[model samples]
Every structure is written in structure tokens, then in C-alpha cells.
Target chain A: MDIQAYISSGILEAYLAGELNEQEMLEVDRVATEYNEVRIELDALRESLLKYAQVESKAPRQEVLDGALKSIQEIEKEKFFEVLDDEPEVRIQRVNIVPVWTIAATILLFLSLGFNYVFYSQFKNTKDQLAALQSDQTSLANRVSETNEQLQYAELRIAHFMSEDNIHIRMDGLDLAPESFANVFWNKKSNAVFISVDNLPEPPHGHQYQLWAIKPGVAPIDAGIFDHNQLVQELKIVRGNVEAFAVTLEKEGGSPIATVDKTFVKGFLKKS
Target chain B: MTPTIESKISHLLAERNKEAIELVFTHYGSLLLNIINRVLRDDEMSEDVLQSVLLKIWQNGHNFDSSKGSLFTWLVRVSKNAAIDKTRTKDYRLSQESKNGVEVVSIAESISTGDEIEKLYAKQLIAQLPGDQKVLINMSFFEGYSHKEICENLGIPLGTVKTRIRTAIKHLRSII
Candidate 1:
């Protein structure tokens, strides 16, 4: 490289003026390092420019520099004091566990209270339900007693007719109506019989059950008429020796005598 | 100042020495103010720029490379740049233009060198350039303006302005 030619190319002036782009500046920096003449030229250029700028230079006030220095010093002092302030307090309070333990206890107490509140509320609800169920049971028992009293009143009404001497015939269901059962309590003196169809279910609609008093030598007699609602009925009893009792379906009201094919229940009583 | 004094200044800046800082205030404070006053020509703003420059030097002295330039050059660059930046702001320029006629003679005289008579004479030789070249050198050196700004301000092409300033410096270098 022609070092003198490089120095005379006006590049040093550009470098001194800070006019060179970064690439050019780097190149100039390299050349200045490699060649002593280039370095001297660059320095001379910078010094000359510095001298020119110094001639036109405007100096600042003393108060400004003083104020800036003072502020920086104050900032440094504040930082030092802050570090000092933090150190002792941190050391003294480092081992204190009271606040941590207090927080833990507070959390535990809250959880315990919450559990107790939930359990107490549930217990209260269960107690209230139990009291309500007890009341319901008492009312149901009272209803059952009332129904029993009504049943006794019906038995008393039937006993009035039954006190007289009458044929007391029991009816056992036959194979055709195996589940059907009835009893005939007859008073021979009053000629009245109370039919308790206790074990018989209600007959189907448009059908009536007829009762008969049967003697082996005679034809069956129409004792009385009964419907489904008449689970127990007071019927006018026939004044005769009844060898056996039988029930059959006739028309809706009943027939003069029982139809033998339609017998749903039958029984016989022994003479006492 | 010797290398020892320079290193001591660097060390004091590193340690953030208050007394050293006060000494800076007592010595170079007025010099910085005078430089800022010429560029900005406003006492208050000059003071502000000087403060900014001193604070910068205090904070960044560890990064200063003496091989690149003298500490004085760095200080001058910082103060000049601060003052120029202040002048570029709308408020400073508007106020400065309005208060343009007020001659800041005392600040200029104080900044005029008596300690380095030969160096001051060398600087004066460069100042004898034509008004346009003089302005270009000031803008480039004192205010840190680019070649582009000098061209725009002086109504010359960028290449021509660069060449002219280079020629001006070459002439100044020969005479000095």
C-alpha cells in the first residue's frame, strides 16, 4: 500500500470530522494501525479540528458541574444508606417464626370452624327430619285405630242378628274358585244371616254373587244377593236345616236359586 | 497534567470522590460553562449543559481511552455536544433567536486561552478561514454536525462542502 497516497486521499479529514461511515471508519482504523504515516496524519487532522472547535468553544457554568456532581454523590450516599438499613433488620428478624406459626394456626382454626359448621348443619337437618317422621308415624297409627273401631262397629251390628239360633254355615272355596272364601253366620230364631266375604276379592263388573242354603235332598234355595262393595253383608237367612252353604254367580242382582255351574265358593257347617 | 494526575482523576471518578469532584468544579467548571455559553449563548442552558457534561465524565471516565484523545478533548466533546443538542431543541432556538443580539463577551473572554499561548495562536490561525468554512469547522468540531448538516446550512453540495472543509483544515495545518 502506498501509505503516503492513502494519507493524501482526504480520508483522514473525513475521519476527523466523523464523516466516514462505519465501514470506512473501520478501514481507516485498520490503515492507521498498519502504517505509522497514516496514524500521524489522522492525529494531526483530529488535533487541527479540535483546535478549530476549541476556538469556537463555549464553556459552561461552574454551578452546573457542581450541581451534577453533588446529585451523583447524594445518590451514592442514599444507596449506601439503603444497603446499611436493610442488613441489620434482616439479620435480627431472620429467626422470628411467630408470624408464620400464627398464620398456620389461623388457617387451621378456619378449616376446623368450617368443618364444624357443615357437620352441625347436617346434624340439625337430620334431627328435624326425624322429628317430622315421628309425627307422621303417630298420625298413621291414629288412622289405623279409627279404622279398627269402624270394623268393631260393623261386627256389633251383625252380632244383633247372629245372637238368635240360626244355621251357622262355613264356606270353603272349591277347585273352580280355590282362592275364594266366605263364612255365613245364620240366626235360626231371627231367620237372618250375616255373610262375611272376608277372603273373597271383588267380582268383575256387571256380575253379582248369589248365596244359597242347600239341603242334600232338596234343591238349593236363594239365600240373598251381594255385590263387590258388600264385602260383608246382612242377608235374610232361610229358616231351614242347611246341610251346606254355597255361592254362585247369577244375574247382576241374583236369581231365585243358585246356578250350580257358576259356583265360586261353597262350605258346610256341622250341627252343634 | 502528568499521567499520574490523569490516573488520579480517573481513580477519583471511579471512587466517586466528592473532594476531587469539587476540585473539578473549582477548576474546569468555568471553562465548560464558557464553551457552552458561546454555542448556546444562554447562561442557564450553558450551566445545564455543563452539569450534564460533568456528570457524564464522572460516570463514564472508566471507559475513557486516553490513546484516542486527551481528557480535555473528551470533556470538550461532551460539553459541545450537550450545548448543540440544547440549541437544536425548539425552545432553545426560539428563545436564542429572540435574545440573539446580547453579546456574551465575558464568557468568550474567559474561554480565550492564556495558559497555552502557542496552542491558542495555532487555533486562531484556523479561525482566519472564510466565514462559511469557519462556520463549517465550528459545526463539525464544536457542535458535532455531520457533513450533511454543514451542506444544508451553508447551501452547498455535500461533496463540495466536505472537500472545502478538508482543504480548509489542510491550509490551517500548514500555517499552524
Candidate 2:
């Protein structure tokens, strides 16, 4: 093949596009290896295509490439473990001997001290252990006290969260369970809807509980979807005059339009 | 192992030479991204492609034959190929073009030259192409659209799209 002519023919473009058959690819690879001119032409062609592509190229967001680099680092770390496995037994033996000698020396020292060392070491060890235990207990108690304070603070926040003067909608569980109830803390000022599903039962796999705000005569708008994993699901329900809030069992990602048959809970907003 | 290219790469690998890897990244990362962005056009997808390209380089550095081409060329090819493959996917092309329309335009306008001569060269080459060719090249290279998509959008045939792009590329290669 006239490698220079072959490369200049724009077949490399087709090659880059994966349009070439196996034989053509092999032929191009062969010529590229054999002739420097072929390789140079091929490289030039690729570069030109790349340059053209670059003009159209958008700057990739930094975060995406950072994620890739992170994964690459992880892979490289894994490869390090593999390399460690390839060490010779002699090297392993040399590495093992130091720890063994240190252990033996410590045993010898303990043996030399005999009963005197035993009693003294036991007393010392016990005292140190007791000190550690006492410290651990004190720290644990402090942690418990701190956690209790945090718990109280969290409770205060929850109480405050529920108390804010906004539309409160109480959803009574439907045929699924009459006793079960949920609450919607609609903060119109913040345009935030917090769904408290504390009382509701877990939906079946492939199903999620969806909240909908229904106006007097209009179709219900999907507020958001909540799952058992979430104690409270925060949603943004855009301003729409609605008479009531309803909950329905929908597919995992929520439905665009609500289905009545899957209705599990309903509640009318309390008028201020 | 002797101090061949393979050995050097292996040593770098064994040492977990982040500096060397980072050097490669800082040097070629943007250029590679530029190539990918040319093909995919959507910033996120292009970024995804750029990552895959870098990962391939890291994993397969030993496979690189410097005797064949420079590392930059190899990276460009890999990035472009990955971007092209991603663009060729039905879901990627459809979702990207629709969801990322305005963002793509803004990104194109905001592309920083950052005082790099190569970047300037690339910018000049792109600028020098005829207006229609430039648009077609931009759509084809950056957005990762097939010639058919370009043709359909511009009301041109596939053959014209391919030839004009090929000619534009040839012109660029000559100038560069």
C-alpha cells in the first residue's frame, strides 16, 4: 500500500469513527507501523480532527473529571495491594524476623523478672487499665449527657417546626389502615412542604408514597414522593390554591398523574 | 525490569506517582476535555468522557507505544473516541441536546484561553473556518451529533456535512 497516499485519503477519519472493517483496520495499523510517513500522516489527521472537535468542544465541568480521577486513584490503590503480593518469600522472612525478635526479647525480660515482676506488672497493668476504664466511663457519660442535650434540642426544633403558623393538613390513613395518620407541615413562606410519614406503613417494593395537593375543582398536583427510609421528606410545592392534601401509593419514582385506586391517605387543610 | 518505557511506567505505578499522573492531568486534561467537548458538546457528558479517557491512560499506560505517537495524540484519540461513542448513544444525544441547550451556549462563550498558545492556536483554527462549516463543525465535534443530525438541523445533506467537515479539518491540519 502507498502508505502516504492511503493515510491522506481520509480513510483515517472513517477508521477513527470505527467505520473500518477488521481487515482495513489491520492494514492501517500495519502501514502505520511500517512507515513513519504513515504514522505522521495518521497522527496529523487525528490531531486535525481533534482540533476541529476542540472548536466545538465544551469545557467539561471540573467535578466530573475529579470524580474520574478519584476512581482512578482507588484503582491505583488496589493495584498497590496486588504489587505487595508479588514480594519474594525471602523479603517476607526478613520483614517477619524483626517482630519475632522483639516478641522474644519482651518474653525474656518478663521471665527474668519472675514473681516480683509478675506482681508488680500485674499491679501496674491493673492500675493503668482501671485508669483507662475510668476515663472511658467518664467520656462515655459526657457523651451520653451531650447526646441527651442534643436530643432535647432536636425535640425543641421539631416542636418549633410543627408550631410555625402555616397550613397544617392531617392525612388519615385510608383502607390500608384506618388508625394510621400523617401530617403535612406546609410552610407557605418558605415554599417548603415537610411530609411527616411517621405513622404510615411501608409501601411495597417498587412503590413509593406520593403526596398531592388537590384544589377544589382542579387536578391534584404532585407535591413529592416519600419512602420509608425518610422520616420527613422536604418538598417544594409551588403556590397553587388547594383545598386538600392526598397521599397515594405510586411507582418508585412517582407518577406524573395521580391514580385514585392507589389512594392511601387524604387530609383537608385547616383554614386559619 | 530494565529502565525501558514500560519499566519507568511500572516504577511510576509502583510508587503511585500522583505527581506524574497530576502532571499529565494538568498538562493534557483541558486539551483532552476540549477534544471531548468538541465531540459531545454537553459539558457533563464531555466531562464523563474526559474522565474515562484519563482512567484509560492510567490503567493502560504500559500499552502506549511512544514509538507510534506522542502521549498527547494518544489521549486526544482516546478522548475523542470515547466522546464519539457517548454521543452515538441514543439516550445521551437526545437528553444532552434538550436538557443542556442554554448551558452549552454559555459554556462555549465562556471557554477560557488561559494564556496557553496551543489553546489560542485551536481557537484561531476554529475561527478561521467558514461560518456554516464552523457551525457544522461545532455541532458535530462539540455536541457529538451524527452527520445526519447536523444535516437535518441545517437542512443540508449528510454528504455535504461530511465533506465540508473533512475539508475544514484538512485546512486546520495544514495551518497548524
Candidate 3:
């Protein structure tokens, strides 16, 4: 083959462009490998292209190098994990290092140690789990007892409210709060008053709900003050001949007088 | 001196030495970036590809047989192939077409000459080439266009494309 004509055929350039079919590329590879002259010519052509590529060279931003190094290190770490995945195979290949009986003895020893460790771990885990279950049971029992006490108290309140000896009065919301409502349960014999505040806006900070027993042409007697957390509360028992019950917002601790304009709800007593 | 440095890099890379990263990046980073940028036509994407190219070279360093070609040749081949693969992806093609709709044509046209190319790669080596030869070299060598594709793209005969690329290579070798 005429080396000069072959070099001039542009096949080497086509090979470098990676445009040749696989067979043609193999042929070019074979020629370049067999002939020193073709190899030298191919290297020179590659050098020229490299120089051409150098013409457009622009330095990448400075930080890209750091980013690249970080990525490489991370990939290296992942590769290390992948190598670990193949560790058992590598260990198997090293079986010839020791005598067969010695190796078997070592394997048996390891198996015994492994079983001991697993049993100990499971025993300790079961102990811890049992302790946790006992603690949970104790807490749950306490909660159940607390709930039972609350249920008993609720039943007593229902019986008291349903008794014929109590006068039940429904209170309507005042002009200040049209949506507020409460029920007054007044026991006739004991003269005790229990008010169930069902729906009332939260009182202003540093304020409390005050109850009063009202009668005609006299100062409104303070019943009792209660926080909003409880729906039903007992108030100071009225003495006798109470006309109506009213609730007002007053500062913490009881006030001597009701803030009439701040009354949230009021109810009138009717003849039974 | 350059050959000695190249051999040092080749050895370090084969050994998987971290020091090879600095040496390779300092020596050929720009050239590789330029090759990728030529194919990608986006500076940001090109830079990203440049990093992966170095990583590829590092990971496959043992495969680089110096008997076949110089280290520079291998780097160029790897970088060019990576960039070409990126361009062939559906995401890249769709984004290129959707970005400006006409940017695809402009990118192809600007392979030979453009304002950005004028400012960035205005080395006197390629600047001094005759217009036709420069265009052929830009498309064939830098853009990785084969002779047949060059023919179809330029609307010239395939024989003409091959002859011009061969002539351009010869002229470039003589100049260097």
C-alpha cells in the first residue's frame, strides 16, 4: 500500500471524526497499528485537531474545579461501598490461606459466637419491650380511672339537673353578645345555683366571668366567679326570693358591683 | 518537557491519584471545555460536561493506552463524545428548539463564525485560515461534523466536502 496515498485519502480524518462504520474504523485501526508511518501521520493529524480545538479554549469558571473534585470524591465513596458488596467473594477466594480443619473450626467458633450474640440481643430486647409495655399499661390504667371519676361526676350532675326540686331557667344572650347562652339550675331546697355556660366568647385577658343573683330594687348580689375552662360550675347559693340570674365580665377576684353593660347573658325566674 | 508532563499525568491517572485532577484541569481544562462548548453551545452546560469528562478520564484512566495516541487526543475524544451525547438527548434538543425556536439554526451557522465566537476564540491560528478552509475545519474538526453531514448541511457535494476538509487539515498541519 502506498502510505502517502493512504494518508491523503482522508480516511484517517474520517476515523478521527468518528463517522466511519465500525468495520471501516477497525480497518483504519489495523493500518495505524501495523504501519509506523500511518501511526505517525494519524498522531500528527490528531495534534493539528487538538491545536484547532485549543483556539476556542475558554477557562471554565473557577468554582467548577471544586465542584468536579467533590463529585469525584463522592463517586469514589460510592465505589468503595460497591467494593464492600463484593467482599464475600474476595474472602471466599482466600480459602487456601489456612488448613481446611482449622478453617472449619474457626467457622464453627464464629457460628457459636454469632448465635450467642443474637440470643443475648433478643433477650435484652424482649426485656426492654416488656418494661415498655408495663409502663404503657400503668399509664393507661391511670387514665381509665380518671375517666371513670369524671363519668361518675357527670352522672351526679345529670341527676341534679333532672330533679323536680330544682328550678331550671334558660338565659338568653344580651345585646352585647347575641350568640352567648347559659343555663341556670337553681335547687329549690338547698338554694344552690349551678350555671352551665355553654357558648360564650373567651373573656378578655386578666378578666373572669362573675355571676349575680338579682332582685327588684336592690344591689345585685355577687354569686361566684368562675374560669371558662369548665362548662358547668357551682356559684354562691342565693338566700331567698331571687328574681333573676345575670353573668358579667369582671377583673380577676370578685368585684363588689356587676358591670351591667358587660352582662353576657341573663335569665328570669318564672312561677312553676 | 511537555511529553514528560503528559507521561506523569498518564501515570498518576492510572494510579488513581487525586493529584491528577489538578494537573489535568490546569493543563487541558480550557481545551476540553471549548470542545464541549462547541457541541453544547451553552456555557453552563458545557462547564458541567467538562467536569464529567475529567471524571470519566479519571475513572477510565487505565484504558488510555499511550501507544495509540497522545493524552490530548484521548481527552479530546472523550470530551467531544460526551458533548455530542448531551446534544443528542431529547431534553437538550427540545430545550434548544424551544428556547428561541431559531437558536438551533444560529448555533449551526455560528459554528463557522459568530460574534460570540469572534470575541472568545479569536486566536490568530484559526483567524488566518482562508474563509472556506476555516469553515470546513470549524465544522469537521471542532463541531465533529462528518463529511457527509457537512455536505448536506452546506448544500455542497460530498466530494467537495471531503477535499476541503483534507486540504484544511493539511494547511493546519503546515501552519502548526
Per-residue lDDT of candidate 3, residues A84-168 (tens digit):
9798677776665456878899999999999999999999999999999988999998899889888887887788898898899
User: Which sections of candidate 2 miss by over 4 Å?
Assistant: A2-5, A16-26, A48-67, A74-272, B1-42, B60-126
User: Could you tell me every candidate's TM-score relative to the true structure?
Assistant: 0.37, 0.39, 0.45
Expressed as tens digits, the lDDT of each residue in B1-176 for candidate 1 is: 33345456656776766655555554455545555665775667767777777777777767766556544445556766887888789989788677665534432333343433334345655535555455555555444456676676557898787678777677767756
lDDT (tens digit, per residue) of candidate 3 on B16-47 = 87678777787667656756766776777888
> Considering DockQ, which of the candidate structures 2 and 3 is the better prediction for this target?
3
Q: Please state the error at residue B153 of candidate 1 in Å.
A: 3.2
lDDT of 3 at A51: 66
lDDT-sorted candidate list, best first: 3, 1, 2
Residue A66 deviation, candidate 1, in Å? 4.2
Residue pairs in collision within model 2: A56-B142, A57-B37, A57-B38, B38-B141, B38-B142, B39-B141, B39-B144, B40-B143, B41-B142
A1-272, model 1: which lDDT tens digit per residue?
98877776677766655555545666776676677677667666655654444454433334565688787888788999999899878866764566778889999999999999999999999999998998898898888888889878777755754565545667878777788788888776676777888666567777788888888799998888876466668876677677887888777887886689988888878857
RMSD of each: 18.9, 50.5, 35.4
- Best TM-score among the predictions, by candidate number: 3
Candidate of highest lDDT: 3
Docking class of 3: incorrect
